[model samples]
Target: MRHAVVIIHGIGEQKPMDTLRGFVSSVTRNQGTDGKNIEFYSKPDELSNLFELRRLTTASAEDEGRVKTDFFEYYWAYNVRDTKVQQVLTWIWQILFRWPWSLPKRIRPFHIAIWFIIFASLALILSGYDIPFMGEDQPMWIGAIGTLLTAMLSYLFTGYVGDAARYTSPSPGNIAERQKIRKDGIMLLKSLHESNKYEKIILVGHSLGAIIGYDIIRNLWSEYNTKYVDGKYKDQLLKFEKDYAQPENVALNIKPYQSAQEDLLYQQNDGGNPWRITHFITLGSPLTHASFLLAKNISELKERMKERELPKSPPVFEVIKNINRFTYLPDFKKPGRVLHHSAPFACTQWINVYYENDYVGGNLSEYFGKGIREHKIKIKGSPWLRFVPFLSHTHYWSDDGNLKRCEASLAILTSIIWDKKMPEKDEKEKQTVQPDANELAGLEL
Candidate 1:
C-alpha cells in the first residue's frame, strides 16, 4: 500500500527543508532505521509551481511498502516587517502589557524585586548624572545611547518572538493567517489527489501547527461529506441509468433501486470518501488553547458560548466539552436500517504525543472523545515547570538521549507512521526509558 504523509511545522521562522530534514532524520535514527534508504527533495514537481515543499520517499522499516512524506511550512514570519525602533517598542509593550510567559503567581513578588534591583544598579552606574524619569537633568547621549542599544537588541530577537505571539493568538490578524493556511492546505491535498494514486493520507503537525491541522481536516471532512455522502446525487445517478436502459430490458434494467442500494452499501461499509484522512498525529500541541485562539470569531464564538452556556469567552474546559469526535454508526436492532450507514469507522484516528515537561502539551483525548489517544513521555522535570518552557517545547524531535529515553512513547508514533500495530502493553504498563539531555538540548537540522 502507498501512503502520503503531510507534516506541518509549528511556530517560529521555519525553512521547509530545514524542518523536514531534522524531523525525518531524528525519528528514523531513533527508531534504528537506516537513513540511507531515504531520498529527500526540495520543491518537488508534484505540488503547485509556486508552492514550496520538502519531500521525502522512504521504505517503511517494519514493512515492504514505501511511504512519501511532504513537509509544509506555513511560515508567517515574513508578514512582519517592523523597523528596529518599532520592534523595540513592540517588545516593551508585550513584556509590560502582554506578559506572554506563564509563571507562578507566588513568584511574582520576586520578579518585581529583581526588577527594582536592576533599576537601582543602573541608576548607580550613572549616579553623578540625573535621569529624566528620576527628575534629574542627564546628558541627552545617556538616554539616546541606551534607547539605541535597546532597539538594536530587540531587532535581533524580534523575528521569532513577534511571529510566535501572532501565530498563537486568536486576534483578527492571526485569524486571517489561519484561514490562509487552511486554504493552502486544501489546495495541497487536491493537488496530491490529482497527481498520485495514494491509498492513505496522514496529517502530522507539531505545536501550533497541530491546531492548524485540525482546521484543515475539519474543513476537508465537511467538503467530502457534502459532495459524496449526503445522498444529493442519488437521483441523478439513478436517472442516468434509467434513461440509458434499452426498451426490451427496460423493465429488468430499471432495477435502479438495487444498483443504488448496493452503491450506498459499499459507501457506508467502507469509507465513503476516497480522499479521507487515515490518521492525525500531533506532537507537543497546545490544542487546549483552541478557545483562546477562536475568541475573535463572533459567530463561532457565539455558537460555542451558547452550547456551553457561558456569558464570556469560552474557557478551555468548555471548548473541550464541545469538541466533536468522529464515531462509527451505532448498532441497531434491524440490520437493514444499518445497511445504508454512511460511515463504518471514525473519519480519522488522532494520536497525540507529548513530553511531561512540555508546557504547551495537553491531553487531547479529553477533547476529541473516543477516537483520540494521548501518550505522555517522562522528562527530567515536572511537566508543569514554568521556567523551561522554551526548552521543553522545541525538543520533541531530538535524535539522541531524549528520543531514546522516551522509547516507549516514540514507539506509538513510529507504529502509526510505519503502518504497523503497536504491541500490547503489560497490565502494570510501566516501562523504563531515559532521555539524554546532551543529545536533545541542541538539535541541528
Candidate 2:
C-alpha cells in the first residue's frame, strides 16, 4: 500500500514547493528506518495539476518498516489575501493588553522577549531614533532610509504575521479570506480521497500551518465520518474513542489509542470506506495558544470545544446505548451512528512536535487533549536563549539541533508517519521530554 503525506507550510511569504522540498529533504535525509539511507525520486504530482507543486517518492524500508510514500505540499500563502499590517498590529495589541491572568503560564516566558521588542520600538520612536543610518547630518537621506524601513516592516508584518492575523481573528473583513483558505484546503483533500490512488494519507502542518491543518481535518472529517462501510458502523473504532478519549481523561496515554485508530482505519478500508486519512502531524504548531488564536479567553476556548466548534482530543462524548461515545444517529431507520461534528478526531491520531525554545509551540495534550502525542524537543541554543519566541520556529526541519527531543524531529516523523517504533538507537540518545499531567492549568491566563 502507498502512503501520501500532504504538508502545509507555516506563516510567512512562503513560495510553492519551498517548504515541501525542505521538509522532504530533512525527513528523507535523517530517515531512521534501518541503517540504510532512503532514496527519493521526483515524481509527477498526481495529487495536483499545478506545475509549481511537486511530489517525491521513496521506496519502503527493506524490513517492511515504512511503506512506499509520496510527499505533497498544500501551499496556502497565496490564498491568504488582503493581509494588512494594521490587522497584525491589532491582533498583537489585543494579545499584549490581555490581563496577566489570561496568559498561559508556560507561554508567558516567551512573551517577555516580544514585550521587549514592542517597548524598544516605542522607545526608539519617542527618542527620535527613526532609522539605523539616519543621522542628523544626512537630512536628505532620511526619506530613503524611512522608505526602506517601511517596506521591511510591511514584509515582516503583512507578508508573514498577516496570514495568522486574518485567519485566526475571523473578523467580518477576514471571514471571506479565511473561509476561502479552508475551502480550498478541503477541496484539495477531497480531491485526494476521490483519486483513490493511495491507501493512506497523512496530513502534516508546521507553525501556523499546524493550526490550519487541525482546522482542515476536523472540518474535513465530517464530510466522510458517517460513510463507514455497512459492517463497520457501531463498531469498536467509534467505541474506543468514546471510552478512552473523554476530554477529562487527563492521565490517559494516547499511544494505545493511536494504535486503535489505525486498526479502525484498516477496518473501514477493508469494508470499502474511502476515507483514508490516518494521522495528523503538527510541527511547532501555535494551536498550543489556541485560547488567544481561536477565542477571546480560555473560558471561551473550552466553551467552543464544548459547543463542538473546535474539535477536542478523544473528542466530546455523549451517552450512547449506555456507552459514552462521540457519535449521533443520523438515520433512525438505518440503525448506524454518524460521528458527531467534532468526532473526526475519534478515528484520527494527532502527533505534535515542538522545540523547547520555540515559544510559539507547546504540547497540545495540555490544552487540546491527552490523545495528542506530544514531543517537546530542544535545539542547540544558549541557556538564556531557550526562552525566546520564534528563535527556533524555523529550525524544525534542520538536522543541526541538539535533538534532546524524543529523537530528531526527523526520527519522530519517521516513527509516526510510518506507524512504527523509534529507530533502534541507543537508549542514551533517546532524550525525551517527560509528560506533564497538568491541565491547561498554566496553559492560559
Which pairs clash inside model 2? 101-445, 102-445, 103-445, 104-443, 245-314
Question: Which stretches of candidate 2 lie above 4 Å from their native place?
Answer: 30-34, 60-66, 110-148, 232-242, 245-250, 320-323, 381-388, 399-407, 419-445
TM-score of decoy 1: 0.58
Residue pairs in candidate 1 whose N, alpha carbon or C atoms collide under 3 angstroms: 356-383, 401-436, 402-436, 405-434, 405-435
User: lDDT tens string, model 1, 1-445?
Assistant: 4567777777665664566666666555534445343444554545633345546665443453445554444433344444244544453354344232332232334446666787898888778775355445667778898899977666555655555455555456457755666787778777665565565667888887787776676555544543334333333322322222222222322133333323332343243345446667888887644433444333555465445332110011211223221121223321211111122113355677887656566665433333356677765434443245446666666544355444555566667766543222231123212234353232111
Model 1 scores a C-alpha lDDT of 0.50
Q: What TM-score would every model get versus the actual structure? A: 0.58, 0.82
Among these predictions, the greatest TM-score belongs to 2
lDDT per prediction?
0.50, 0.74
| Candidate 2 per-residue C-alpha lDDT over 207-297 given as tens digits, one digit per residue, 9 for 90 to 100 | 9889888888888887887676364434444455444745483577666777666665655555556787878889988888888888899
TM-score, predicted candidate 2 vs. hidden true structure: 0.82
